[model samples]
Target: MKAFDQLYQKHYPTVFRVAVKMLGDSDEAADVVQEVFLTLFQTMEKGMVVEYPLSWLYRTTLNKCIDKQKYNGRFQKLETAPEGQVEFQSIEKQETRIRVQRALGKLKPVERALAVMYSESLSYKEMAEATGIRFSSVGKTLSRTLKKLEAELKNKKYELY
Candidate 1:
């Protein structure tokens, strides 16, 4: 109990930020944080040996965020599809955010997760550790993923946003 509380205090902000960045929703991010802590408590209760709890939490958060996107695909599309008319979000900052989100949607789940982590300035080693990908391949994979995302954003036409 005390250990879990200490873990939560140390990592809650980062976990919540990762969730919000991936899912783009405050409520859902909060839910992910709660779920992660609950799972941690349950696993510890079962006496599992977690060698690296922070890495485990990162992996779990990414998985849950991806699953949430999968489950809410339709709702997400409906929310971000710009409807028939563009709202007042044509201003540069909001427009760029929407464009980025759209491009992210087109990426594979792993790519999306990696890209978001990269955007948050996580090191390649950290990303690889969290994702279980080969450490040496993290840089190459992230570069390739970024190139793909850039191409997608370009192909979608910069004028639309």
Candidate 2:
């Protein structure tokens, strides 16, 4: 119990951030985080020993985000307007974040999960173990996911400049 609490404290922020990035809403992200922790607690109660708790938490959060997106169909629209048009500069930052989140939404759930894990510096082996996929597939999936994201961003007129 103490160990689980420590683990939750250590990893909750990262989990919530990832969830927010995936879901694009703080409220939904908070729900996903809570659900992830609750599920973790249930699994632990059932005597499930996760080999890599961080990876497990990340994968769970990613899955939860994907599930929510699927059920809500929130990814159908791409809200892309110039950030500068917003009244506040802070809204500009938010717009940029939303653009990125919308791009991420276009990816398949597995692809999104792989991209998130890779972006977070998780190695192929770690991703494989966490996602139950082959290590060799991780590189290819990540490459394809990146290409898809690039194409989506281009279509949305979100240029780097």
Candidate 3:
């Protein structure tokens, strides 16, 4: 119990950020967080030791986000960073966020998860562990997913510059 609380305190922000990026809605992201913690608690109660709890959290969060998106059938409207988490950005930054969100919506859920992982600066090894992709394939898959996202943004006249 104490250990789980500590773990949640340390990792909650990271998990929430990933969920927000994947789901594009803080409310939905909050729901994902709740589900994630519940799963973790249940697993612990069953005496199943998670070899790598951070990886498990990331993997679970990504999977839950994918499930929520599939169930909802569309990405919710994009907004600036979650309230109080980030200071207000300039209009250009906000617009860019919106464009990126829309472009991300076009990606398959796995690709979107890969992109979020990449953006978080997670190493290829960590990404592969969290995403269950072959380690050697992480770089190639991420490159392709990024290219696809760039193409989507460009098609909408959102220049990379």
Query: All candidates' lDDT scores?
Result: 0.80, 0.77, 0.86
Instruction: Indicate whether candidate 1 or candidate 2 has the larger lDDT.
Output: 1
Q: How much is 106 displaced in model 2, in angstroms?
A: 1.4
Per-residue lDDT over 1-161 for candidate 3, one digit per residue giving the tens place of the 0 to 100 score = 88789889999999999998998888889999999999999999888898889889999999999888889877654533445534577767766777888888889888999999999999999999988899999989999999999999887554534
**Least well predicted 10-residue stretch by lDDT in candidate 3:** 77-86
Per-residue CA lDDT of model 1 for 22-127, tens digit only, reads 7767678899889999999999888887788888888999999888888986327523534334465566656666677777777888888899888778888779
Q: What local lDDT score does residue 56 receive in model 2, on the 0 to 100 scale? A: 88
Rank ordering of all candidates by TM-score, starting from the highest: 3, 2, 1
Ranking by lDDT: 3, 1, 2
Least accurate stretch of 10 residues (summed lDDT) in model 1?
77-86
Superposed by TM-score, candidate 3 places the C-alpha of residue 157 at a distance from the truth, in angstroms, of: 3.3
Q: Which stretches of candidate 2 lie over 4 Å from their true place?
A: 76-92, 158-161
Local lDDT at 132 for model 1: 81
Q: How accurate is candidate 2 locally (lDDT)?
A: 0.77
